[model samples]
Target: MTTTSTPAPPRIALHRDRLLPAEPATRGIARELYAAVRDLPIVSPHGHVPAQWLADDVPFPDPTALLITPDHYLTRLLHARGVPLADLGVGVADPTSAQSRAAFRLLCRHWPVFRGTPVKLWLEQVLVEVLGVDLVPSDDTADDLYDAIAERVADRGFRPRALYDRFGIDVLATTDDPCDDLAHHAALRDDPGWHGRVVPTFRPDRYLEAGLPGWADRVDALGEAAGVDTGSLAGWVDAMERRRAHFAEHGAVSADHGHRDAVMAPLDAAEGERLYARARAGHATPAEAETLRRGLLFEMARMSADDGLVMTLHPGVSRDHHAPSRERLGTDIGADIPVAAEFTEALRPVLHAFGTHPRFRLVVFTIDETTFSRELAPLAGFYPSLYVGAPWWFLDAPDAMDRYRAAVTETAGFAKTSGFVDDTRAYLSIPARHDASRRADAAYLARLVADHRLTLDEAHETARDLVTTIPREAFRL
Candidate 1:
């Protein structure tokens, strides 16, 4: 007797105008607009893509680690639905083929949780568009799908550098610590076989927050890296400046900050030093630590004003909301949460000092959507130094992005907004996420054209700038 196997679900598909307008006339214009910029080389000005990955040019260890675990959006949602991080291969450095296959199956069994989300969209692209997998993930077909992706990932065409070339990335910037040696960046820049651009953006949040754990060690490391003493606040400042110079020399153009609030208060030189001294001695209270943090914000603006590194500030994220999970998994493991942020008053001090400075440039990002029209847009409208960053991270979904365009364009206009930034640690999601933003922008611009607010030619040119020139100019790339 011959037995026939039951076939799996249909192969996945993406609509050519997946995010275009609902109206027929508007969809027509959006289709034209999307076509113009769909193939433009990606310009990623700010992200967490590890420079080491590109420099090493290595094959991905496994499909599960590469596609499922590193993505907080995927892991966090699954965690919310009663999945343990360890079961998904969260802490394992080099998972075995069996363990990796198990995690992939876990993800497949819970696939319904990802329905109608940006994470789903990005994963679909990675599976179908990038890997050419035919199976839609589900419990019935998990093992087969895993084998299919695992086989593709092991091929030479799937190596990091080869994929980078295929992704059409022109400029890819990575977020990094001020104390980092950036040796990987130097390696990529100097490699003859590699032509991809991977630059670093200085991130000094933990080092500035004195009350945070490991501040003392990080401060010492910064001093050692810069060849400056850290016994005094002035020495610390000098060390920071030296590191910033080093970063710029190796092709960095910007610095990034993720403050709990947007406050940038002025401080006297002696007073600032006194607070820092107390912090080093482990005597500063939380209030003192916060004050010192705000004061450093002012100094950071002062330095950027002098050295010309564009400042990208995203404030009001309540990180490590789940204390136990954070303790177990460490930072950026999907435990962070968003909170309301204030701007006008908190930023007045720095804005007044550097708002008109020729060398200073600032791009502000918020997870607080209420402030988009009420605060950020108006501030960007008035200050020459200010621009609104892309709606990303928590707000990278379709509706929030469309709302972002509507909220800011009236006050700041397209010219004063930072172009789309795919801020991900996931290398494979780079083009997929950027494609989402492009489609969203096309739909929004098509509406403007339909409403007679913009001409088709004007919309076409704006689409080009949003993907290419805006990010380049905003980050000074």
Candidate 2:
């Protein structure tokens, strides 16, 4: 068979009214609302970007490394299409020039795989808006686009700190392990030349998971980091508290909890001590470890209530669904899948204790949309300390975001929602992700205005608050 490839577009253009309402009257309102918040400063409370990137201020290595490799959203979809993770530079520490170019070609050739996905939208924005690429991504234009992006990233203007400023980020929070010294965060804060606010979020998931391997050793490490003894359960709690204080001293505003579920029932002190002793001795049964893990989650919430760090909970993920893939490539290779989440009963224990506490603040996130209206909104509707987190993980797409707004807003309303969170490791896509969210919110709010549920002025104010005040209040930024 003889065939000719179609030529790529000369210039890729993004629509100005993208993600807005379809009807003319509603579209007009959405445009206005979107315009009001399109350029607002982003306040990212929860994300996976490393603080070292900003502290070091290094130029991105290459197009594939910067854009393709680090983004699991792109890689996972490509992997589903029978592409090896290595082809996309997933496990390569430093992919060679040839390898990089080859990976870029693979992405371009498979451009159709991303059609109608948020990954496509974010990549488009990153390429055209951020990196100044002209031609659409395709096999024919891969090398040209790669060269263009490479030239741009090589420029000093594209360094991490410079891009942070250009992205108009008011504050960016990075997730960090409990044992992390946060030296990079300290360096960024203490640097006289830097004025940007980059804070660390205390993520103690691994330490709290008593069921995992090396759980006992992780406890020792935490104790060593906190300069405390972990020979007893009291010392373990003391060590965690000390580390939390250390993070707070370095400008942490939130504590992140990611468990298999949202269960937070606390165990009595004697039972907790018994379980801790068994786990520390490597003799605790799986069931005992799980009970201890749930108790640890409650302890974390109790600590948050005492220390004033906003507690952010995102649960119900069956991480590393494919064991062989995890064994070969490692965790977070887009193998983590969401499971059904229950919040009402699961969170009743913690909510009962701290639901009315003045110092406690809780932001709940989920990948299960079923819980939005059925559980999350109703829960946040009553608890003064609770705020419904934005659509997260698998649900961060354009349509999912619109659905999220519709599902939660009826019960909890706009003020009770936690605004948008990018929750990304792809640093360059931050603005694009936030922009997409703003557009989705605008579309949803515009429909309300068109239906006379809200006035245009009220919608405008809501659009502004969604970008600014809501996140600030939710995360106590």
How does each model score on lDDT? 0.91, 0.92
Q: Judged by lDDT, which candidate is best? A: 2
Write candidate 1's Cα lDDT for 260-334 as tens digits: 999999889989999999999999999999999999888888999999999999998998888887777677888
Model 2 clashes, total count: 0
TM-score of each: 0.98, 0.98
Instruction: Name the runs in model 2 displaced over 4 angstroms.
Output: 1-10
Off by over 4 Å in 1: 1-7
* Global local distance difference test of model 2: 0.92
TM-score of 2: 0.98
* Steric clash pairs (candidate 2): none
Candidate 1 achieves a global lDDT of 0.91
RMSD, one per candidate, in order: 1.4, 2.2
Error of 1 at 151 (Å): 1.0
